[model samples]
Target: MKLGVVGLGSMGYGIAASLLRAGHEVCGADVNCEAVERLRTEGAMSEEIVTAAPDLHALVIVVLNSAQTESVLFSENGLAPKLTPGAVVICCVTVPPDFARAMAARCGAFGVHFLDAPISGGSVKAAQGKLSIMASGTAQAFEAARPMLDATAETVFKLGDSAGTGSAMKAVNQMLAGTHIAAMAEAITFGMTQGISPDTFLQVIPDCAGTSWMLENRAPHVVAGDYTPHSAVDIWPKDLGIVLDAARASKFSAPLTATALQQFIAASGMGLGREDDAAVTKVYARNAGLTLPGEE
Candidate 1:
């Protein structure tokens, strides 16, 4: 298969490398010239993505949000017009289901298969090609995307026979994920107020019922005082915004998710927007006037 991956951030870069290793001819592009050159050295084709359109069997868009995803496919230099009729587009952004449905319809006009495929398991898993993919699309879209999915995913969940469902499920997952991160911050900080160290919280929490993938993955960054952004505080605002918007449309009450969204917002407002999301703990620490470890 010939594949083109746009947006070579941590996740996109890994997905492109995985495709390249799976014997697919991969063309990778990004605004980051350094990343493109690096991947080029790793056997990725150096052509600008637009130039590789007609040759690509699958075009994976792992950008940040719905607008960027739409821009990549429909912008002035967009690939849709240049794509071969049966080519598939696997959209892996966190977006609303209605947006996914709309994109699918538009892609249908050009005979391009659009799969609403949002991914999980973060950058490390992405590098190992073991991410979990929540995917939904028309049968033709699935058939066209299967090879690429097989190359990148450890678990490819077929959510439905249309594009929106995958986005719907992704919204659900983000609600829980965003909430978990905020909850972890709250719990860890609360433990500190009672004289428990972040290290102690981490050691005991994983075996408790409160443990979650997000907590185990993120809490260590707090304990080590490594605020480097594997996933930034800004990401949750976008992801959880998608969740709340979806919930609003469906009249679903997501009070817990709503509260969690506020903490990330506060963290970003405090100029911590680009920090690792575990930095949400700062919101809790500031409130209680408790200094977290590694902080002055």
Candidate 2:
């Protein structure tokens, strides 16, 4: 398949690499010139994405939010208008259900297939071509996107036969994921106040009932003091904001999600926005006057 990938950030770059590995003709673009150059070295098409857009059979958008996704598809120099009819767009941004539906509808007008496909499992899984994709769209959209999905996803859950359903499912996953990361920070730091080391917390927690996927995945980052961003601290605010907005529209009270969102906001405020999200533990560490791993 001839594919175009926009964004080329951690997740986007990995998805593009996976497509390249699957022997697809891939053209990649990003604001980061280095990322685009790196993909070019990995055999991605050297032509500009705009130049490649019309000939693309599929375009995988892995941008940060709905705004960027909209700009890529509908704004000036948007690629949607340039795509051939029956081309598929697999949108992997974490966005609201309504936005997904709207993008799908607009793509329908252009005879393009839009897949409301939000992904999970972070950078490592993305690099490994093992991410979980929560996806929904028309049957034709699914058919159009299946090859790209197979190249990039280890698990693809077909949530429903419509655009909104996949985003709704992703929202639910984000709510829980955000809360668990925050809870892990709280518990690990509380243990430190009682003289439990971050290393000890990691050793014991994974075998305990309190262990969660987020806890297991992120706690090790804190233990090693490596704040290298597999997933950055700032992502929670946008993702959780989507969850809370949806919850609000449904008149749902999500006290836990609200609280977790605040902690991530505080982490960002503390100049850890670009750090790994496990650094949320820094908030608790500061409050208790405890030094964490990698702290002086």
Candidate 3:
């Protein structure tokens, strides 16, 4: 398959690499010249995606938000108009359901099939070609995107045959994901206040019923004092914001999601936005006047 991947960030770069490994002809584009160059060295090409747009069977868009996704597909120099009919667009960003529907409608007008596909499983799984994709779209869209999906995902849940269903599922996942991370941060720091070191918490908690997947995954980052981002602190504000937006539209109250959003917001406001989301523990640490592993 001939594919184009826009946004060579952590997740995007991994998806492109996986596609290349699967013996596809892959082209990558990113605002980050260094990331683009790195992909080029790995047998991915960067020769003007627009020129190859018509020939591409799939374009996997892994940009950050709905706005960037829209700009990449429909704005000046966007590729939607250039792509040949029957081409599939695999949109892997976290976005609202309504936004996904709008993109699907727009792509339909151009004779392109849009997959409302949002991915999970973090950078490690992304690099391993083991990510989970929550996807919904027309049967034609599924048929068009199957090769790329096979290359990039270990688990592809066919949630529905429509645009918004996939995004709605992703929003539900993000609500749980974000809340779990925040809860892990809270618990780890509360342990510190009780004279339990992080190492002790890690060593013992995984054996306990209180342990969660997020705790197991993120607690090690705290133990090592590494704030390097697998998922950055800034992402929650966007994802949880999407959840809250949808909640408001449905007239549903979500106090827990709202609370989790505030903790992430506080983490970002404390200049940790670009750091790993595990830094949400820093908010708890600051409040209790205790230090994490690497701090003085």
Candidate number that wins on TM-score, 1 or 3: 3
Tell me the deviation in Å of residue 9 in model 3: 0.8
Q: Indicate the TM-score of model 3.
A: 0.99
TM-score of each: 0.98, 0.99, 0.99
Candidate 2, residues 164-269: lDDT per residue as tens digits? Answer: 9999999999999999999999999999888898899999989999999999999999999999998899999999999999999999999999999999999999
Candidate 3 lDDT, 64-127, residue by residue in tens: 9999999999999999999999999999999999999999999999999999999999999899
Off by over 4 Å in 3: none
- Candidates 1 and 3 compared by lDDT, better number: 3
- Please report the TM-score between candidate 2 and the true structure: 0.99
Error of 2 at 276 (Å): 0.7
CA lDDT of each candidate?
0.92, 0.95, 0.95
Report, for all candidates in order, the number of backbone clashes.
0, 0, 0
Residue-level error in angstroms, candidate 2, position 293: 0.5
